[model samples]
Target chain A: MNLIAFAILALLAATAVTVARMRDLWAAIMFTGIYSFLSASWMLILDAPDVAFTEAAVGAGIATVLMLSTLALTGKEERATTRSPLIPLLVVTVTGGALIYGTLDMPHFGDPSDPIHLYPNPSFVEKSQEDMHGLPNVVTAILASYRGYDTLGETTVVLTAGIAVILILRRDESHPEQQESP
Target chain B: MSIEQVVGLYNYWIVVFLMMTGFYIVIARTNLIKSIIGLNIFQTSVFLLYITMGRINGGTAPIIPAVVADAHAHAHPADAHATDGPAGHSLHETADELIYSNPLPSVLMLTAIVVGIATTALALALIVRIREEYGTVEEDEILELDRYS
Candidate 1:
């Protein structure tokens, strides 16, 4: 509708195309940062300032920087001729499409009259004194108290990934490579 | 329909298309950095999804002014008159003033973004060590040496 939104959409599309066609890995990494910034702009246009902030900081800022760092350690040239991955592509396409289609049955974007409002959350704001949790933000209360178990699971996932990374990149102190004297 | 609904809707579709394609690249391709790029796309699409969900119809920026903030103040039972209509109107105004927003997904998204950054950082660190150990970072090179080892 607005110029800003149009610019963001254009940039988003261009970044996707560039990322796809990019031969150099570092250029693709740079475009990933551009893509993230455009996505954050779209988020801001959608009226979620908090989400916009996080997307800009984490998605564009930290994530892009780290990815580029990895690229620096690795070679920039992508494989010249990779094998055709038809089967995996088909599987991923089907699964992702089904999920996107399923999201269509969800409430329209930003509809004021949605099931989200019909939840017990309104009661928390209605009777703040009655809420046993002292948190002012209902979302925090729900995440930390009501759905505490799910958060614990997420923490465990992070822990598992950390352990896996350590194992994958473990040191070779016992078997040092033989060096020749100059 | 407003232009927001018309053009804005397609914006979501583009994100989804790019996202799925990028994810396909990650899952199908063997290159580590390519997989990371694909993961970036996947994460960006989710941010789009959350931001789209948070957009409110007929809603202005959420900054609250001190005077206008009083509009949301609720009246206790003691302050109520013996009339039901005025009480009902007061209650309606209070609820309406504090517009119902689903902040849960957005809050969760914030945590997700942080976790995404952490993962990326850890992944990069691993790649550095992987390069040191293997003398190369390409998947084919690593696999070639791995097969022989």
Candidate 2:
């Protein structure tokens, strides 16, 4: 398993380095796929089959397709050859390192006693014993009923994004004066 | 001292690395398309985090096995007043493997994936329009032109 883990880590590192060095937009997009695919494999190993599937389907599939299309619309190469900034890099590195150190006490991966899983599933599952909402699935009941407000907010966000996308894409100024060819 | 622990321990760090790399690309890259790619990677890492937390060890799922039910019958020794008759048994793996996964996160991830695809498609459509209007997609150049206007 560690062998597979190391392989994934190395693959991701390679993608990162290639993304940095690749000047061609097409090449960069391919490397981005490599990065996402490796990440999905890691997700599978993590016992998160659902997250893995989404990562594979959306993160790797839909996102890559959209990016390639965008690249077609945009110029294939970077427009400006600006020098890199070292200060921002250093600052970001230090801040990220500090944050990682702070998380050192986080529960080890898949610890049975981890608070995340053992927190409250049984209590919620036991909810059927009381109210008799006739819900077999504790998760479904919790989201659709117990915390319906949050789900409503999420649905609203999704609908709003769709509307915004339609509005932005439909903004076509059709009446333009024709200028004579110079 | 088994296969589970090894796969389990390193699973999370891989997610973190991929996530950080993706985030760095999103922030530092001037290309809008590249930033979108980075965003995908960032989201992928998050999905990995959610799924990895759901793995349970040595637990053959919550479903009841037929053999275990049969054993309970003999062990009962003809006790007629047994309230719990191994109801969790006779459940095949068809119930999505009743392993101890918090289905809430999985369901949320599905919604998020749909939302992300919609957002990306919309963004790409907008990028096409931006190209047609501005005749270029470079952010710095666009900013410079906007400043002059």
Candidate 3:
């Protein structure tokens, strides 16, 4: 089990690095799909099957297709940035180090006694069954009932995004330049 | 601190590494599509981190019992033995005995995944419009062209 987890992590790391380094936009897009797939597998190992399902569907599936469509609209090859990569590299290093430092205070992975698992008020893992009216899937209960307002807001955001995209792209399509170029 | 602590927290280190790589990609890559991919990678790594935090090593998925044991209890209130005996299971016992994985983070991340995709769509749409207006998706090229125009 540990070996499998480590291997998935390694694969995720390797994919992320390759995506970072590769200048070919198409290959990088494919690698991003691979990265999402690996993370979904990791989510499965972590017992978040729902999250894994959503990630696989949204991240690897829909996002990739949208990216491909965008690629169709835009250039295929990425022009190498003439600016030095040093500043970004340094900034990422500092940010990563800070995040690692933050994790030191976090509860260890799968620790049952962790506040999220054992705590009663907000985490809701403890009394989700009772509080949510005997709904077996606590995630569903929490999302649909307990946190209904948040889910509603998320749905609204999605609707707004769709509208915004249509409004912007529809305007672009009427342009003579786009028709002439392609 | 110790080997045990490091071993237990190794998952977090992996999360950090993935986060950094994604962040670097977004910053360093000039292609609009590739930057969006980087953003996707960054968002996905975050979901992994949240899911990892909620896991229990030996826990099962959060699901209700297979059979409706409560109906039997209702039919024969006097003989409460069915609820406890080997023949039939108790409704409460299903929840009480099982060490179910935490579902809260999974729920939150599900919404996040949806939002992430929506944002990606919007971003791609904007990239398309940018390509139409500026005739290029590379940041440097767009900046140069826009400045001259």
By lDDT, the better pick of 1 and 2 is 1
Stretches off by above 4 angstroms in model 1 are: A1-3, A85-93, A123-182, B1-12, B60-64, B71-101
Residue B94 C-alpha lDDT in model 2: 23
Interface alpha-carbon RMSD, every candidate: 5.8, 6.5, 5.8
Q: Please give, as one word, the docking class of candidate 2.
A: acceptable
Model 3 chain B: ten consecutive residues of lowest lDDT:
B83-92
Put down candidate 3 lDDT per residue, A64-169, tens digits, no spaces.
Answer: 8989888877878888778899999999999999999898888887777677765443324434544555566767888898889999999999999999998987
lDDT of candidate 3 vs native? 0.79
**Number of clashes in model 3?**
0
List ranges where model 3 is wrong by over 4 Å. A121-134, A172-182, B67-94
Please provide, for model 1 over A65-88, each residue's C-alpha lDDT reduced to its tens digit, 9 standing for 90 to 100. 777767777778887647776787
Error of 2 at B65 (Å): 8.8
Interface DockQ of candidate 2:
0.27
DockQ of each: 0.35, 0.27, 0.44
